[model samples]
Target: MQPTFQNIQEAAQRIAPLIHRTPVLSSESVNHISGAQLFFKCENFQKAGAFKMRGAANAVLSLSDEEAARGVATHSSGNHGQALAKAAQSRGIKAYIVMPETAPSVKKKAVAGYGAEIIMCKPTLQAREDTLAEVVKRTGAEFIHPYNDERVICGQGTAAMELIEDTTALDIVMAPVGGGGLLSGTAITTHAMLPQAQVIAGEPQGADDAYRSLQAGKILPSESPNTIADGLLTSLGTKTFPIIQELVSEIITVSDEEIMAALRLIWERMKIIIEPSCAVPLAAVLQQKEKFAGKKIGIILTGGNVDLEALLSKF
Candidate 1:
């Protein structure tokens, strides 16, 4: 079954102790820069250094004792791997993480540090799936999909839930769209709780399949996405696509240059380190200044897992 508002509520309660209720922060400088009153739902401060922890914890905890005893497995670029590993460690179960060989070393090391066994595969969707299938088949581990599961969607929605609860009368809520998990959850929460608020999504121009999919009125798979925001490289999931098409108000695409500018601005002005994927929404806001001007907006700053050397080399 698809996740519901009640599921999100339950997820909040279920993962409460397991995750931090990350802060909602605002920067006066950023507000002036974007021409909006921005409330950043700082999930970058979350456990596992990303909002993926909420979904990973909920998915692991929702399993039956017998199912959990078999352990869990998934293919991730980074954050979800770390999150699943952390959750499994906390539950005293093994986790098998299948990761792309191209994924940042920082993230790979972090996943390893969490005690999950890492299986590296060629950096393609097919290779990751094939590798994960072998691991799960061999170990009898339950597959917990990164973003396509109902429990995960519900858990991801809690970030937006907390954002709305902490702020009042938001005109719009925004998040980056990749596999559409966070955006789907954000749209669901905003639609149910702050019905008046519009939920917008930002996509990198280099990987604008979500934007194209919405325009095409169907799920268009992401092919060879090349963006500095490595976290937003996946295609939209079946479950996440329906929610996004129905509840999300709009999607805006921005260039890598715009994303880098927004990233630098946030780093310089807010004095916080955020991954490039986390900068997409803020980039959209800055790019479309007229639409967001003077509006109260909430943006989810998704993660902080950046490889300094790799990122610097990109420039």
Candidate 2:
């Protein structure tokens, strides 16, 4: 069940009233600097404060009555956990969210505010997985993977669908790549609907697995990521990697400093608070300004879950 434009269309219909049709913003400053027309999909303004809500809601809805009765479980760094919790609660279903202890307090509080059970683990992917597995086994909860599942990808694809619908004829579309879910989904939708448009991925240099994997034509695992973009830490998943390889045009890498600079630009110029992971695409534009000159580019501002105080202290 590979996610396609058709699946995304259906997902749009399914999650329309449940999720916000996040605004598409034009940035004059970004346009002037890059010499390109820039349209930003403001998913930071989305419900649950990120685009994860669309996928999470769609995945939860796709479950059968029996499965929903059994409840759902997933592990996330932050945004997806809150999304899943809210979505599950909408259907009167229990959600068990296993999150790393290193996850931001805001996200943990958001999940708890949604009345979902939160299980904290050590700050490692393996630890989160292990804890989530135990919770699933004990509670008989159906596992809802954050990014590796088709339904989730289909839901994610809807973001590009909305963007394309709002502003047609983009030369290139760029989004930050982490687990490759959003990038893969964006690729699938854009490749199908706007075949001429190039779909590129923006990745952190600190976690350059996606960039290396795309170049080598294979999935490369991340070796202990240490990036400021916390959301861009995961290695590409099996399902997302194949789709990305097929549909994505390229993967570009940016430094942590570049990411931070982009974050500052967004906050200072656009008056938006986007996470470092979401800033990677904008960083790519700034890094490769010559390549994008005079082109129409679409950037996905994927999330806005940054810790303001922590971010300010970094300055």
lDDT top scorer: 1
lDDT of each: 0.95, 0.91
lDDT score, candidate 2: 0.91
Q: In angstroms, give how far residue 192 of model 1 lies from its true place.
A: 0.9
Model 2, 155-184: lDDT tens digits are 999999899989969999999999988888
- Which number leads on TM-score? 1
Q: In model 2, where is the ten-residue run with the lowest total lDDT?
A: 305-314
Model 1, TM vs. native = 0.99
Count of backbone collisions within predicted model 2 = 0
- Give the residue spans of candidate 2 off by over 4 A: none
- The alpha-carbon deviation from the true structure for residue 218 of candidate 1, after best TM-score superposition, in angstroms, is 1.1
TM of each candidate vs. truth = 0.99, 0.98
